[model samples]
Every structure is written in C-alpha cells, then in structure tokens.
Target: MPSDKFDVLVIGAGLAGLRCARVLAAAGRDVQVWEAADEVGGRIRTRAIDGFLCDRGFQVLNPAYPELKRAIDISDLRLQPFGAGVAVRRQSGSAVWVHPLREPARVPSMLAHGGVRPAGVLALLRWSLPALRPRALKSSQRQDRSLREGLDRQGVRGELRRVIDQFLAGVVLDDTGATSNAFALLLARVFLLGVPALPSDGMRSLPRQLAAPLGDRIVLQRSALHVESDADGWQVHSPDGVVHATHVVVATDPAAAAALTDVATPPAHGVVTDWWATDQMPPGPAMLWIDSRTDKPGPVINTAVISAAAPTYAPRGHHLIAATALLAPTATPPPEDATRQHAADILGADGRSWTLLTRDVIPEALPAQLPPLRVRQSVRLAAGLWCCGDHRDTASIQGALVSGRRTGEAILRSPARI
Candidate 1:
C-alpha cells in the first residue's frame, strides 16, 4: 500500500466508519480506514480484566435493529438474552414487570402481586403503540414533545411512570426525561420486538464482527489531526504522515467529527458505570433492576447481575455486577459509596464483600436524543467530504450503521470529480 495515498480515507474505526468502508470496499472502491485506538470498536470496546470481560460501558445488541440485521449475521454473535422487563426495587421488595407478549406467564403473577396497574398499562399502550406504525415512527411526520410532557399527556403516571423514567434514563443516559418522546417510543418498539443481549465475548463483538472482513484496510494507532481539501480531493494530516485521498469520510465520535468537519457539535449525554465482582451472585433471572422506592430514588439508575445474563463475562466462580448512574453535563460522577449502597439496596444483597472491578466515567457516552428528533441527518458535507455516526442519526448502534451505509450509498451514486 502507498504511504500517503488512497482512493478514500476514513478517519475512525468505530461501527460507522467500519460499516461505511465495508460498503464502499465491497463495491470495489479503494477504501482505507484509520483508527486512532489500538483496536477497533471505539466506545463499544471490551476490556479483559483478570478473566472478566468488561465492556467500556453497559451496552447490548438488539437484533431487531434493521441496519444491524443487514450488516452482520446475528447467529454469529452467540447472544445471551436478558429477560423481557425490569425488576423494580421498592422498599418492601422487588417486582418484575414483563411484556405480555414476551412472557405472558409473568403477567398474571405481576397483577396478582399488585405489581402492575391496568391504567398504567393502558397509558403505556396509548403512548407506545403509535411507534409501531411506519408513519408515526418517522420523526419528521409527527408533532414532537419532550418525553416528560409526552408521558404526562398519555397518562403514564405513578409507579409505572417512575419505572419507565428510571429505566430510560440508563438507556439514553438522561434521568430528566428531556429526550425526545418520539425517539423513546421508537426505542420502546425495538425492545418490545426483540430482547437486547450480550454476545459471548462482549459488546465489542459487534464491532469486531464488522471489522473482520476489512482486515488490512484498517490502520490502527493512526489519528487524523486535521483535514483539508485540495484540487485533487482531500488531505488528512496525522502524526504519522499526511494521507491524500480522492474522498474522505469523517466517521469519528461526535466531538472528533466536529473538530475535523463542518458539522456542529451536538450535546452529549454522560454516564458512569461501575463493575463489581462478587462470590455470591444476586438471585434473579438476567434482567435490569431499577429503583422504585416511593420515598426517593438512589444515585444508581440501574443495576444488574451481568454474569447471569452472560456467564462468559465472569470467571469460573465469580459473578459480575454492573451499576450505572447518569451524569449531568460537567457534573462529577456519583461517589463510589453512593452507587455501591444503591446497588445493594436495589438488589437486596450485601455488596460489602464485593470487589470493585472498575469504574468507567464516560462524559460523552452518547449524543443527546433531544426533542424534535431529527432522523437521517445529512451526511454529505461537500462534494468530496462526508461524515457519518450515531450523531448524524438516532444515537445508537442502529443509527451508526444506517448513517455509514447512507454515506457509502450516497458516495457510490455520485460521480467522482477526481
């Protein structure tokens, strides 16, 4: 390969970059992907610590994502599934609220135990059923509202509302319910359609699967410092050397992408995830637990026995648990003591003996899915330059793949100036 020339140069090796390059390369385009990290997967990476597989943050792969289905074969992931619904932790005890379609048997028990209310169920249906329709799912077609206002208008209240709010806080990394209601409904539709799960290795498996075919096309430890357009095409400056290409795709994270392209920086949602190892596993099926105490919610938004969901995440006899807290912009992460105590309270376990594996504080975990959600944001910045990532779409694995594929398709359809 030439040291500083290519048909196309991609600036990041995340899902978006890899998927974009894959599409272009498959079409016989000379594409080379440059990733600053030593490995691929970007934010979705997994770390091996003392025989434990720890993902950078709490993440799962939803087979229901349309783009994901088209990009990679799901069977290869060896997915370990989580239960249909969450375990709501109250002062007295915890109750599991599952979807009737996924786990009908649990519905009866849930009702008999006063875990669910008919009004809340009806309200939830009213708010979420429209998401199933093609037209309503399109953000551009409907009247948009903040999640908090939308829930209020739809009558999703009381304990059910609390559970939904808390659970979604972890999902979107925002506890304030300021995210777009339409986006939340779309997210709910996917969860209803498919159970999110972890691969045998970790969330990193998703990116690794996408990167496998590209092989040598991906250049690791290579970061593009600046990008400039020339008469021929574009030039990407890096610490290593300058690379000139007929076209360039800035597929890095939102912050990095903003720096290298004309794209405006989007607001980011932060999250703090703590992984704990314990000899005694929490007794429960593989499901998320959210605090629903009538008094007051704790610092932790959600906690789960990760090992129960994917045993491969832990060593032979030990178990892995994860507790996640939403971080406000410029706010320090909740103290370790608070999160640990909240985890214990929510799980009804004594985590005093548990070992703290690691704490991951990602201030830019995901782009904020704010109100008036804009789906399919433009990828074509100029004739020969493009950008693609979750920020350009729905802020998810699905969005990243879709945006990348969109850029690749758009580029393929246009005539090359060079």
Candidate 2:
C-alpha cells in the first residue's frame, strides 16, 4: 500500500537527482525528491565552522559544461578564477609553466631562475594540442589501456611523465596506472579548454541553486530504503512512507546505486583533506601547488591556499589552506603532523604558526574511472525504472548534471509517460 502518488519519484537530492526532478516538474509532471541528508547537494556541499567555509573537497566549477549554462546562472555563483598556471614544486626547485600565455615580463624571471626548460615547455604544449583536436573525444576501436600506456605512446618520459602523473592523481584522485587513457584524454580536453572557478557562496550553492525552485517538491531526511517494481509502476520503500510512482530514479552514491539496480559499481578512492587556518597568507600568485618531487611522505599530491584563490573561504582577517593526499585501498593515512609537514614542504609556508582545523576523510570520494570509459550511459533501466549519476557517466560534476538532464528528457520522450 502506498501513501502518496506522483508521476516520478526521485531518490537522492544530489546534483543528478535535483536536475532530474527539475526537468520533470517543469514539464508539469508530478515529481517528488527524497533526500536522506538534512540538506541537498550530496557530495558537493559547504560547511560553516568557526566562521570558515569548507567545501566537501577542493572543487572548482567548469563553465564549459554544455548543460551548465542551461541549468543554472553562472553569474549567481560569483566565480573566482585560478591563476594563469599551476606552480610545480620539486626537490631541486619550483617553476610556473604559465599555461595562460607567454609574457615578455615572465621570460626574464623564468630564465633567471633556471626553472623552466625548453623540453618541458615543448612537452606541455604538445600534449595540450591533442585535447583540442576532435580525435581526443572519440573512443578508440582498439584495446582499452591505462593512462600510463597512453603517455608512453606519446613519447612522454621522465619529468613530463612524473609531472602529468602527479597533477592528474590529484584530479582523478587515483594513481596513473589505474586511470584510463581515454578518460585522461577526455579530462585533458575538458580542463585545457574550461576555466575553473569557485563559487563565492560555496560549492553547495551550485546544487542549492538547482534545488531552489522546487520548494514543496523536495522531502529531506527521508531515507529511501528499497525500490520494488509493481505491476502498475514502482513502490519506493522509505522509513517515512512508501511512495508509488510511474518512474523511479536512484541517484545515490555507487554502493546505494549498485544495491538498487543490481548494477556492478566501480571501486571508490578515499581522500584525506587537512585544513589549516592562518592570518599569514603564503607568498605567491593565486595558483594551485603540486608536488613535482619524488614521493617521501605518504601519497601527498597537491596543496592550495584556497583563500588566495577565493577570499570567501576564510574570515575577514584569516585564510584557509587545504592539503590533500590520496589513500590506497588498504593503507592508513599519515598522521596530521606528518601531513602538515608535507604540505608545508610543498607550499613553502610556515607550518608551525598555522592552526590545525578539522580533517575530513571521504572514503567513497570518487569512483575509479579506469579504461574503456563511456562518456554517457543509458538512462532507461526498465519500463518504469531509471538511473543517473556520476558513476553511470563520467565521475564528474558535468557528467552528473548531464546524466540527470538526459534521464529527465528520456522520461518525457517516453510516449506512455506523457
């Protein structure tokens, strides 16, 4: 027996779920959103603690997402741009590749420091060109392979290999050997062309902005336990009540999505982010810092004095610094002291004066996107059941938003539903 009825019952209030419901409801279809958490935004959230804003992870928005412009207003986010290029920190020295453009002013400094090289400069530009080409997006008819193999084919070795692997490990949150070549190329295509921006309100605002118009349509703190298809449509079991609907959408994390659809879910990677507050800002352009040196302390990858990139993250007189390290499946993360030390070494900041904030460990942070990647997945799971999520598509914000939009459109396209 069911308590309420709707044309579509959406489970999970994450980016995908919200986007799906937004389309369905806009089309005059009866849509209801159920979220287990007290608030929406799922993995993309912002928390206010001690007068500081901490995002779920070090996240920036990509406006080049084909659907983003249609989904939400970019101006409302009040984006903050990252510096022209990233600062690569190595054991011997550090250098900025200046991804934005070559400047006459920077040439003298680069040459004087002896940090920039002709070979490395050539390698960076050479690989970036492929991202702009059409073939980068096309899936190969050949055998699937890892990013390491792809780099080898491009004749990338030594410094270039190490640099790409470390930078990408921060992006994919997985080791290079476990990452897919096709996926890596696609990522390169997305990033090389896209401008990264952080919302002034916070990362959570992106989803919150999406969920805003659907006032009464959303039900929070209602954990949907199971989904059972009936002769008529579908019954979603929840502790609050079972809702009957013609279409059921499961937009939860990989484990929950796997349980509902019986679809095999990919392995997830755990990431540890350590936060530190300091009145003293690190000296540098507002840019991301990555370790270009050999690994010494655990799997430290990148650190950002995020406040320098986006001032809204910190209080009026203070700043926020986040240091991220990827964890192996069965490996324990390094202690906070060691982690702070590692971050200081990479950031060239005084760790002793900084105060430690909370440390967050998201076990299922990102789904492992290995070889043979599909940019999109079929939304129609059954006659009345559907699915959409980062796991179904690319493990990314754009993929999640696109998947939700596709599911919504697919449902509307079904003749019986209309």
Candidate 3:
C-alpha cells in the first residue's frame, strides 16, 4: 500500500457520504470526500434569508431510527418535538378535527364528530393494533394493500378516508393510490409510537455535524466524474484533480450512481415546498394539515406551520407555513398566490398577513418506495467499489445514514481498503 493513496474516497457530500467517511476515518483509514455542490448536506440543505432558516423541503426525524445514536447526538440537534396524531380537515365539514390518539380522553368526542362513523373507528383500531406488534412488519411488506387500500378494505369511508389519505400523503409525498402497502404498516407504526422531531437550527445541521470531524479531508465543488481501477488500485476522477484510493464509495443520487456503477436507476419522487411567513401562528401541536380536495389550486399534499415545531426557524413574532405538493417530472410548481391562498384557508390563518418567503422544488425529494420494502439494502456494488444513498437504501435520513455505515463496515473488513 502506498502512503500517498487514500484508503477510501467518498463521493458526494450528502448524509451517506459524510457518514461513510466518518466511519472509515474512525478506523484510522485515510479517507477523503468529494462533493459537486458548494455546500454540504445535499437535499438536507438549509438556507438563511432575512433571519429565517428555510429547509430545502419539509422533513422530520422519528425516534424509531436506531441509527441516530450511531451517527450523531440528539443534543447537538436540539430537537423540537412535534405532537402525536394529525389534525384532520374533514372535506365535508370544512372544519379541522383530531383523532386524539395522544389525547385518549377526546376519543368519545372524536367518535361523536358526526362525520366519523362507528365502523371507521373499528377499522382504524384493527389496523393500528397490528402495527404495534412485530407481525405488522412482515404483513405490511407481504400484503398488497397500500395505506388507502387497507383503509378501504377495512370499511373506512367518507371523511375518515379523506382524512387518512390527506395525512398519509404528507409522509409519502404522494396519494394513497401511489403508495405501497409495505409503507402503510410502517406509517401505522409511526403514527402509534413514533415521536417526530426536527433540529432547532435546521435539518442541514445533521450532515454538518457528521462532516465536522473530517475537517479538510472533504473537497467541495468536485463531482465524481468516473471511477476506474488499474493494477495500481482505484482512480476517482474529479473536475479539479483525481483522488487515488484503495477503495471508492459512490454515494451520489440514483441516476449518478446508476451511471457510475452500471446499476439500474430507480424512479424518484419530486416534492415542491413553498414557504410563507406570518405574524400569527396556527394554533396546534405542530401537526400536519392535508388538502382533501384535488380541485384546489396547487393540489397541496400537506401544510404545516413549521415555526410551531422549531422556533429558531423564524424571526421574532413570525411563523413559517410550508405548503407542499407532489410535482410531476419536469413540471413547474404552482404560483405563490395560489399556494399561499390555499394554505391560509387550510390552516385557518389570515391570508392578508401571509408573506411568501421562498419556494424550493426538489426534483428528487425521495426515491419511489413501492412494494417489497426491505429493511436493509446492499451497499457493496463491485470489488473494491461501493455505493450507498437514500436510493440504494431507504428514502429517509435513517436509510441514508444506515447504508453509509454499512458500506464503511464492509470496507473496513476488506483487505483492499488496507
């Protein structure tokens, strides 16, 4: 082994890239990271404009991800907790209501809400009880029922169906019809037991924390053009210079990884988020608000007054509402006027006081997670070459970090990385 060669060269400064580098570095391996973007955190980026910290998209971390303890500490994130259960806006009543799983005392009130039928309550309970059990994991993956289909089969109708679809769309960034049944079980589990949270500073703080230890080992604005191997080992070509490494980790997006590794590129889902600032915060426990109507302008998937979740996200006396919707491939986002007007009505906030701050349209917000949701994805792509990312693993932060760690572990054991 040449002293000048890097033990591992990680491409992409996203969550997976940083995590892979950190693990390799900890094992006394000489590692370097390359990123095409000027800044780190990839899609987890946060921007500060006029004293407001706007996340690239709406994201939340659930406590169920055990990987959090492995990569970073919760205190560094200063997590802001979002209350359990969603606030449903009954399409029939033109009013907002709650399921009260958190407030069990309100169960009777929820039952008598006139819109919620008795059969709906039974169906919801039948689905929820299994999520708490271990069997839900297998059942969800094996069954062909998506969240919407499961609800319908259980005899859930009218307002309950609307409420369920509206809320689930926020998590999956798509309608119930498009979501897989495997995810439905996971959704039930999260709804029942998970505690949703966010970093007080911004979501990007997470990737920053992971990369902080590497210091100068990471190079920015240099994308991984191509990776090849010779008798001398691996050569990772970049715009500025080439990195000579014993092993190479391709931690880029789906399409890039597919191009680099000759692996199939899966379809990606697009999510467009528009932010608005207002003096009055929508009253609640940071619950998600969904649009039950498709005819509504922008056809918003979900809206949340994020300032309620993280106060540092906004300036004094102001709140931020993020109106989100699924975008078609290459389609433009709806105008700000329509998004704001629709959001104001959904959250019951005054439209006059709302001000548009910024709109971030992420073409690849998440990988399309359909049927056969595996608990883990393989990280090794070829001999001495590895790949890891949300596309190669789960579509959430947990999947990205976990896959990166898995790649690091495999690299550590390989004699090639020595």
Ranking by TM-score: 1, 2, 3
**Residue 195 CA error for candidate 2 (Å)?**
3.0
> What is candidate 1's lDDT per residue for 1-418, written digit by digit as tens?
4768888888899999999999999998889999999999889989999999989988888888888889998899999988888888866877888867888977888877846788788998899877877455674535888999989999998888989998888889988889998899889888888898999989989999999999899989999999998888898899987888888999999999989987999999999999999999877667998888777546888999999988999999999999998888899889887898889888989989888889999999999988787887999999789999999999899999999899999889977654
TM-score of 3: 0.91
Candidate 3 stretches with Cα past 4 Å from truth are: 1-4, 92-101, 133-145, 282-285, 293-298
TM-score against native, each model: 0.97, 0.93, 0.91
Ranking by lDDT: 1, 2, 3
Residue lDDT tens for model 3, 1-418: 5534787888888999999999989998888888889988878888887888888888887766768788998788888877565665445434335546566776677677636677877887776655666455655456555656666677766667777777777777776466665566666576566568778888888989999999998989888788888665788776666668878899988888887888778777888888888888776557777655535545677788888877888998988888887777788877777777777777766777777888888887788777766656678777888899977766777779988999999998889535
> Candidate 1, after superposition: displacement of residue 332 in Å?
1.1
lDDT of 2 by residue, 1-418 (tens): 2348778888899999999999998998888898999999989988887878888866778777767888999889998877756777866757775554424467557645636566665765665565665354555626557877777766676655777888788888986467877777777776666657789988998999999999988989998888898876988888877778889998888798888887678898888888889999887667778777765554577888888889998999899988888877787887888878888777777888888777878888998887776677787788889988888888888889988999999989875542
**Candidate 3: clashing residue pairs, number:** 0
Off by over 4 Å in 2: 1-3, 101-116, 134-136, 141-144, 295-298, 416-418
Q: Pick by lDDT: which candidate is best?
A: 1
